[model samples]
Target chain A: MTTYTFEPRLGTDRTALYVEVQQFYARQVRLLDDLRAEEFAATFTADGVFAPSPGLPPAHGREAIAAALRAAHARRFGTEPVRSRHWYNMLRVDPGPDGTLVTHYYTLVMVSRPWDPAPVIAPSSVVEDVLVYEDGELRTRERRITPDHQSF
Target chain B: MTTYTFEPRLGTDRTALYVEVQQFYARQVRLLDDLRAEEFAATFTADGVFAPSPGLPPAHGREAIAAALRAAHARRFGTEPVRSRHWYNMLRVDPGPDGTLVTHYYTLVMVSRPWDPAPVIAPSSVVEDVLVYEDGELRTRERRITPDHQSF
Candidate 1:
C-alpha cells in the first residue's frame, strides 16, 4: 500500500480552494451538456491534454481538445434539439506540492432521443484530472477519462 | 449550482488525516477481494448502513451489512476457486464538520472465469460513503453504491 501525502503552503485556505475546484468541474460539465465544446476545451490550459480512455492517444492542446470533443458529440450536435447531457459529481480535490490540483469524479452521460420520452443513459466514466491555477484562473493540465465499457 | 461549505476545527492535520482515510479504503477493498465478507462488514460501525443502489433499502448494523455482503457474493463465495475481485480507484476524501469523513470513488468489478484467459469486467459503480472514527478506529457510517447501468 502506497501512502500519499501533500503539504500545501502556509496560510492556504483548503476549504475555499476545494469549493473553487468543485465549481470549476460543475462549469465544465455544464459546458459539455450545453453543447459548448469550444468553451469546454477553453477550461483547460493552452497546452492541456484530454484522454478519452486509458489505451487511446490523448488530444493535446486547447484546439485539439476542442476538436476531439466536437468529434465525440458530432451526432448530437448535428441533430436538432441537442440532447446529450453530462452529470458529474462526488469530486475529490487534492492540491499538489508543485502548484497543481488533482481531482477525480464519476460522470454519467445521457441522451434524449426524439423517439424516447426521457433520456437514455449510458454507463458512467471516472475522470481523473490534473489542474493548475494560472493568472487567477484554474485550468486543466490533463484529464484522463476511463469509461466502464470498452468499445474497442 | 449550490455551493457547499464546511469548516473543520482550525488545528487539524488535514493532509495526514487524508492519508489515514485512504488507507482505510484500501484495506476495505483488499478485504473484499480476499473473500473476507465478515471482516469487510467489521470495517463499519456497529450501527452502520450499507445501500447497494439508489432507492433500495439499506442494510443496517454490522450484522446486517455482513449478511447482505454474503448474499451479494453468494455465487462466488460458494463456488470453488473464487474469482471475484473489486478494483476501487480515484478516491476523493473530505472531512466533515463534526469529525466524519465523506468519500467517493469508482469501482470496477472483475471476474476471472475458468473459461476465459482474461478477466471479464462489469460496469463500474460510483460509491459514496460516510465514515467516522470511533474508539481510535475508522469505521463506515453509511455507504451508497450507484451502478452505472440501471436494470428496469
Candidate 2:
C-alpha cells in the first residue's frame, strides 16, 4: 500500500495526528480484505463503534463491529478475498466544541457481491468524531454518522 | 412577505427572482388546486439544461419545457395547494454562457393535500437552476432538483 499525504486537523500536533488517521485506514483496509481477527483488532479501538451509512444496524464495541464487518463482507463478497473501494468527498473538517471532535461532510459509496455486481448503496453523509490521543497515538472515542440515505 | 433584510446578495432582486420561481411553482400548485391557464411560459435559453442530482428526468427547451412543467403540475399536484416551506441555501445568480443561470442549494419541505402527512415521501432536495434573463424578467433556462433520498 502506497502512503498518501493528506493532513486533516482536529487541533493539537498536525503531523502525528495525520499519520494516525492514515495508519488507521490502512489497518482497516487490510482487516476488511482479510477478514482476520488480529488485523481487525489492530484497526479499531477496543470500544470502537461502527455505523454503516445504510442497510445495517449500529455496531458497537471492537469485537461486535469487527464481526459485523466480516459477516457483511462474507455475505456480499463471499469466500474469495473481498476487495472494496472507498470514496470520501471532502466538504468541511473543523474542530468541534469538544476540541477533540472533528466534524466533516462526506459521501460514501460501497458495493458488495451476491446482491448485485453494481454498488448496493451510496449515500452522502456527515460525521462528527472525537479523536482521542493517548501514548502519542490517536484513536476514535466515538464516531456518529447521521441522516444517511437508505437505498441498500 | 415581511421583507426580512439580508445582505444585498439575498435582497429583493434575488427574492424577486425566487418569487418568479414561486410563480412557476404556483402553476403546478394551481393545477393541483384545479386551475388552468390559457398560456403560461417559463423559458430557458437555447443552451439551458436541468440537472437532476438524484433521480428525476432533466429537461430543456422553451415551449416544450414549459409544457412539461405545466403537465407535471397537472399530474403531480392536481389542483391542491402546496404548503411549501422552502429554504434556498446557496443561490449564485450571475451571467451565464448564453444569458444568466443561477445555481443554488435548496431544501424544500412541503405538504400537499391528500398527502398531508406521509412522512415526506419526496424528502427535501438539493436544487440547481440555470436561468435566462429577458426583458428585465428571469426565466428558467434549466431547473434541476436532486433529491436527498431516492428509492432507486
Candidate 3:
C-alpha cells in the first residue's frame, strides 16, 4: 500500500492560511471527539449548510448542521470507544469571489474500539471538503466530501 | 437546489480547454457506450490505473481497467443510456510532477432507460483523473472517481 506524506498546506508557506484551515477542521473533529456539541455548532457560519447530496438529508444553516452533528456524534460515541482519525490527503486552495475556496480530500480513516485489533470501520478512500474562509477564519462555504471508496 | 462548475486548465482558455477535455471525456464515454473495450481502454495511457474505493471493484492498469469497463458495459448497456451533456464539475487541473494533476467532480449522467436508473456506486464524489498531453492530445494518466454523493 502507498502512504501519503501529510504536508497539510502542501508546502504553501501561507502559514496562517494553512493553520487557519487546519484549525477549522481540527476543531470540527475535536468537537466530535470530545462530544462538544455547542462548540461544534458554533464553528459554522450562521448560514452554513450541509447538503449530503440529492436524495440525502440536507441540513441547511449552522443550527441545522449542528443539530445533525450532535445526533450523529451521539450514535457514534454511544457504541464505539471513539478512536478515529480524519486525514487530509489531497488539498486544493483557491481564491474565490467571496473567500478562500479550500478543497481537501480525506484519504484514509480508522475507527476502532478497545480490545479490537482491527478497526470496526476503516475507510479506504478519499473525501473532498470544499470550504470557504472569511475574515481570516473558516466556515463552510461548502463541504463536498466525495467518496473514493465506501464500506457498509 | 444549487449548481457547481468545473475547470481543469487555468488562464490558457477555459472555453477551449473545456471543449478539449469534453472531447476526450465524450470519446471515452461514447467508446465505452459502444462496448468497444479496446477503444475505450485506449483512452488511457498504457500505465493508467483505476483506484476504486470499497463497496466498488478496483481495476488497475490499462488492460485490467479496460476489461472491467467491458464487463460493466455489458451489464449497464441495456439498463442505462449514456448522457449527451458534459457533466464534468469542479474540474481543476494542476501541474504535477509528471503531468497535470486533474481533479474534477461529476455525477449528472444521461439516462438511456428511464425504467432503470444505473446504480449509484463507487467513486462517490468526483472523477479525479490525472492527465498527460502527448502530441497535443490528452490521455488519462490515472482516473480516480471520488463521489460526493453515495447510494447504498
Per-prediction TM-score:
0.59, 0.38, 0.43
Output the TM-score of candidate 2. 0.38
Residue-wise C-alpha lDDT for candidate 2, range A1-152, written one tens digit per residue: 11122233434544334445546655555556555745564444566667764345777777777677677767765776434654333222334443453534333435565546765433334455555544445555556664333321
Number of the top candidate by DockQ? 1
Ranking by lDDT: 1, 3, 2
TM-score, candidate 3, is 0.43
Kindly list the per-residue Cα lDDT of model 1 for residues B1-152, writing each as its tens digit. Answer: 11223234433766656656655665576576556878998998878889998867899988898888887777444654545546677888887656677899888775554434344567689999987876667788889999988634
Candidate number that wins on TM-score, 1 or 3: 1
State which candidate has the highest lDDT: 1
Candidate 1 residue pairs in backbone clash: none
Q: Taking the tens digit of each residue's C-alpha lDDT, what string does model 3 give over B12-90?
A: 5544454456446645654653467777677777777776444576776678987887666556564444422113445
Instruction: Encode model 3's per-residue lDDT on A1-152: one tens digit a residue.
Output: 11122234434434345445656776687775565656766666566656543335767676777777767656657664567665443243444443345454433445667887866433333344545544445666455443322211
Using Cα atoms, each model's DockQ against the true complex is: 0.10, 0.04, 0.04
Q: Residue A112 of model 1: what lDDT?
A: 81
Candidate 2 error regions (>4 Å)? A1-30, A33-38, A53-57, A77-82, A97-99, A110-125, B1-152
Provide backbone clash counts, one per model: 0, 10, 17
DockQ class, candidate 1: incorrect
Going through the candidates in order, the fraction of native interface contacts each one reproduces equals 0.00, 0.00, 0.00
